[model samples]
Target: MQATLMIYDGTAAPDSEIPRTGGVPLAPEGFIWPLCGDCCGGPMQFFAHLPVEYGVLSVFLCQNNPGSCESWDATAGANRVFLFPPAGLVAVAVPESGVTLLPAVSAIKTQVVTLEPETGDDDELPPDAYDLARSGWEREPGEWFGKQREVLGSLGGSPSYLEDDRLPGCPSCSGTTEFAAHLEEGIDRQTAMNLGGQLGYVFVCRPCSEGAFLTD
Candidate 1:
């Protein structure tokens, strides 16, 4: 299998039309910033701005009260993912209260990575190919532990180690959603969107123009 890895490429303007994390989200006219519906009921923090083949995915999660918000659940109101038209998107107006945006805008660049599933004993389950590939991303040979910060996430690939029952159903159509991307926290913990130390998953229902987010 193969995956398109999103690599950290430094800072960018908050409203630039580029694939990135921690930037002001761009949305179509009349789009409002999403509020957390699980706990605290405050505004959700903007996480990523990803441009895909069909549209732009604007993701958000609650940081106002992290663990208590159940941000890892696909059906939880604490997190959200929106798919908007590729054009006519403008920087959304930030709300005056609560956590609304990430502290830094980290730009992204893509690199295609080839992944091969590990072969193990018949009784021993192999590690996820995507997870294995992600963990092994290195800038140079034998420098295994130093370059993990450069791996922002991946563009297209199967969910890493996610169970079948956890696949999210679209709220609009009540149909299974397709895997869109995988998200890592970021280069710096202080500036990264909190995921409770879990990898984030993004799913979309193109026909209905809806998206879902979860973590594992």
Candidate 2:
């Protein structure tokens, strides 16, 4: 299988139009920063700004009182994902209170890697291709361990290890949402968006211009 990995490039301007994590989000005029509805009832932390085939996927998760909120649940109000149009986007105004942004703006670049299918007994569960590709990212021989820090996540691939029942339906049309991207905390924990050390999943409904966020 072929997987497109999102490799960490370096620091970037917070409002730059690019694939990145932990930057201020770019949105259309009159956009309101989302508030966490599950717990703490504060502004959600901006997690990523990804440009996709249909539009830009802007993700957010609750950081204040993290464990108390269900940010990992797609239907929960603690986390949010938005599919915004490609043009006429400007940096959103930051909220004065609550955890609303990450400490760093990390940029991303893509690398396509070919994965070999796992050869296992028929009774065994199939391996997650995206996980295999991510665990296998290496800058050089014997550097796999260290190089993994540069892997932010991936785009346009099936949700890794995600169950069929967990797939989110479009909130508007009740149609199945397509897997959009995978999100990692980041290279530095201090600047990373907390996911309870788990992987994050993004889903979208292009026709409805809506999206969902969850973690596992």
For model 1, the local distance difference test gives 0.86
Provide the overall lDDT of each model, using Cα atoms, as 2-decimal numbers.
Answer: 0.86, 0.88
Error of 1 at 81 (Å): 0.6
Q: Where in model 1 is the C-alpha error above 4 Å?
A: 139-146
CA lDDT, candidate 1, residue 156: 73
In candidate 1, position 129 carries an lDDT of: 58
RMSD of 1: 1.6
Top candidate by lDDT: 2
| Angstrom error at residue 35, model 1 | 1.1
Candidate 1 residues 119-178, lDDT tens each? 888998666756666777874666656477788888877888889999999967889899
Write the residue-wise lDDT of candidate 2 on 12-129 in tens digits. 9999998999889999999999998786789999999999877999999898887888999988789888899999999999999998989999999999989888798999888777
